[model samples]
Target: MAIQFIKKITFNHPQSLLSFRLKTTSSQYVASRFRDATFEKFMDHYKNLLKVISIQDLILANPKNNPPSVSVDFINRLSQKLHLNRGATAFLRKYPRIFEIYYDPTLSKPYCKLTPTAMQISIEEAAAIQNTHPLVIDRLTRLLSMSKSKTLPLRAIFKVWRELGLPDDFEDSVLAQNPHLFHILDAHEPNTHLIKLVGTTPGHENFTAAVENWRIMECCKDECSVDRTEMRYSFRHGFPPCMKLKKNLRAKVKEWQKLPYTGPYEEFTNMKKRSKTAVMEIEKRAVAIVHEFLSLTVEKTVEVEKISHFRTWFGIDLNVRDLFLDHPGMFYLSTKGKRHTVFLREAYERGCLVDPNPVYVVRRKLLDLVILGRRGLRSGDHKLSSSESEEDDDLLEMENDQGDIL
Candidate 1:
């Protein structure tokens, strides 16, 4: 097999290497753990991490400048929705910066709201969401284009719409407004709809190039080989080098890779009776489809469970975990949350995403502010001013602050 790196294609300019460089000891430690841990361990760690993120998400999901305080009962309900094993009420009380607990004694309810700093973070996050609205449309379009039907169920799209940076009611706000680019089709079941692309867009071209580029690279190994026996291990060329110890693994992968490439627009109706080669092609495309979907995300990461909800639409038959285990170089499973999540490896470096969306840049600032707020809360300093908090955020100043933020 040829020992060659996939020629890096510049999707967008990466952030300044100096700014995103991992300098923190804790970050270095986490990166090291990720590299050494097995896939199952990584997933367990991720699930634990998601429990905290769920609390953060709940606070951020609130609307209004002075968001209504949520009750302990509300948090408990959310725990069930997010599949969190622990009591969210207790978690909220533990993390004051993320959730400030107060009792509405007359109502006999314990209410929780974002700390002052969390509120400030939410305000800034709203601005970032508005700023990245255009990019969100493009990203969503890319996702729709990569689907086997060139359409996706509204339920599935809504599941990740927030993560993808789309507004809560994007179907009405973004999709409805862009009639030329998108439309909706009612499914047999009422209230369930599919989002379809009106015509071929740049997303289709990019998805095609991305999948074809990978295929061309794989086929290149075979092109240069003179010995038929050497082809036995060729399929393993694209897989992570760690899997070489599993005997016959390369042989199985070689056979799989030889299957024909299927475009996202193609149908896989008779999948059960399809020839082994045809079935292999569907699975291969599923890997590429997942890769393309991750690339379209603002963070280049998505909850693995969210992808599972769209398996039928995306034509992915295998479990989402299996896909990541099979393609290590293309994807990295991160234990950063309570749920299993996967990230595009080529999009990250030194623990930071290489090609971060503009909105992500703002979100980073919000995170810094949240961390500062946490410190202040831990120290029992409730009177911290917004200006002081902003100063402590450690963000670079822009020439036109108002314009840059919007």
Candidate 2:
């Protein structure tokens, strides 16, 4: 389902209305030591692993199935239906511990069965979902609060569920159950929906505080500045420890950072808006909102463009790639996986998130199970080795060539 945004919601004031435009710039695909390689590796390793889990879940949920073991042919067909380029046979062989491969000698065919370990993991994941229900709601609250219209199209929300660490069908299961917190609106497009926060303002106290804190830090750095060129570099202290800066690159970044900007949360609706100034502020606030959003995530990072879906709502009418390039100290853009993702520099240290969540721990454990299965297969420790047909060569294709996936 696609979200057909009929019109971007704009502030009534003409002063606030600016044509959304972004200046195109060449991107330097850079890597940082604090890029949370483990998380990235897990996601890459499980890209198809999770697909298998989703398939298993779908099969198990079928009321007609008694044992819930789906045939290999059924999984192959389901893979096509789900657009899973990675064939089910390869996936089962890749993660034998999760998917019990039962072959009937007479028929010479394989049946995909969920292993006990996988079953246990499902139970643990369910428990984690139950435990983190409140946090998930709070996460939803913050997401809605950050939007300019204080609402998000349901289709957009669905796309970023994995990044948000939300369970499948959360809109129906979790969101639908909470009528007092969220209101689902029927849009002109059938099955397309909009989600609005109930009785809540768009402004979030935490985001406001973060903006103030950043300002205070900037001011303190300004006091010790040597010159205009050096003044911009003064804020380099805010950069994460892993950010190794080259002198020439540092100068270039400082010059870009010196551009005048306004806060994302500030009342720009009444201000005399210079197009360049408004754009800079909008981009800055986009950064701030993203920073705050990531802070609330179990992992303090998200797909770069996933946050861009709120561009209209956030009043960000500029290229987000420019923002990441200009503000390397604040955010780290990683091209590790299929998508280029943005990570909060300060929130991560030594390839791991500095602030870890319990739910993340549970998820990590589940990931470990998948990794162990792969290890077992690699080591030939498992007797379930089956030569499966290979496919999904582009399963790891880059999601976008530029920053416009938003």
Candidate 3:
């Protein structure tokens, strides 16, 4: 099946002038390794936060939404589906600010519902998604543009839809509404489809990569030391403080920084993967592609496994895990939960997203509710003691420090 798909797509293009300049001596080096504690903690928090959000959505979508509550017994029956390591009741109780437990006199049983604050925040989140509809369309278009075939599998897009801030009915509401921009075609597999750009021109081909914009901004700053051209191709690195670079490694990194390669939006179809230089350029282009994708994401992170679904669609002919692991300075792989997540290191500071988008800002309010726990409860509500909250913080710090270096 994969072979058939590959045969159908052609990745040929006229060689660009930039291709000849990259055919220089290429030095081989082992993958550079480092770890950031801050990003690990960020991922750790999201591990449970994401599960909580999923459960919240499930409750909200229930048919019995008149009271917007579900029986404890019902939730417990689907504990495995919720991915809860603990009992459903216990898990729901952990975040009192988001979930409230109450006894129903008529039903004579305990039921869970979103707290008032959580419900309000949920409304705001919906509003934010609605307001950012245009941005979501633009992001989706740029993503398809980055692919070698100017198209991507609908399944692949669905996997990262939440991260891209796409609406649940984006296929009908967004794509269907923008017929001039996108077209959905049936795939060879049953129930599968492909989303292809409707009209791609030379202007679309010349769109600037996210990293290139960052470089341009840096070059405009008075304190910038690197040349504009060098910065354009080079990636920003945020190595851990504990990492000590050897002289040889430093030289290799310097050489890599100055290496010229095609941007993620540009095509490098004429370059063969046989030579060392071509191999290096291809690897760098993969980094650029992943970097640009994360840049388009609300959190600047995505599960490593989710990206694997795009290997064929994106024309990335290498292991995605190794690609991220090879470029630790540009990316950080966090094994915090069942799935590993890749983060764009430059997009974060300490532990927060450096540039928070509107959708992300609304989503963070939901996370803040989870982090608040029982403290956000009102009078007569279940609440944690101050000491218990402190204990929780200590445990989180301990977990964050575990396996600090990778």
Q: Name the candidate that leads on lDDT.
A: 3
Better of 2 and 3 by lDDT: 3
| lDDT for each residue of candidate 1 in 1-406, tens digit (9 for 90 to 100) | 2333222223323553334454456335435432413334334333544455566666556655245566678778877777655777655554565567777868898777776766676577677787777777777877776666788888998889866888767878789988888999999898898888886444445444344554456557746553444432222233334444465765665556555566554444545658877666667777767876776677777888898887887767787766775666567766544445787767665445666766777656544443343433324555445666555543533233334324
Error of 2 at 297 (Å): 2.6
lDDT values of the candidates?
Answer: 0.63, 0.63, 0.80
Backbone clashes counted, model 2: 1
lDDT of 1 at 165: 82
What digit string (tens of lDDT, one per residue) describes model 3 on residues 244-321? Answer: 778987788788888888887877685745798888888888878888998999889999889889877777888888
- Using Cα atoms with residue i matched to residue i, what is each candidate's TM-score against the true structure? 0.65, 0.67, 0.83
What lDDT score goes with residue 67 in model 2?
52
Cα error, residue 390 of model 1, in Å, equals: 20
- Clashing residue pairs in candidate 2 are 148-313
Deviation (Å) of 97 in candidate 1: 2.9
- In candidate 3, position 90 carries an lDDT of 86
- Show the lowest summed lDDT stretch of 10 residues, model 3: 24-33
TM-score of 1: 0.65
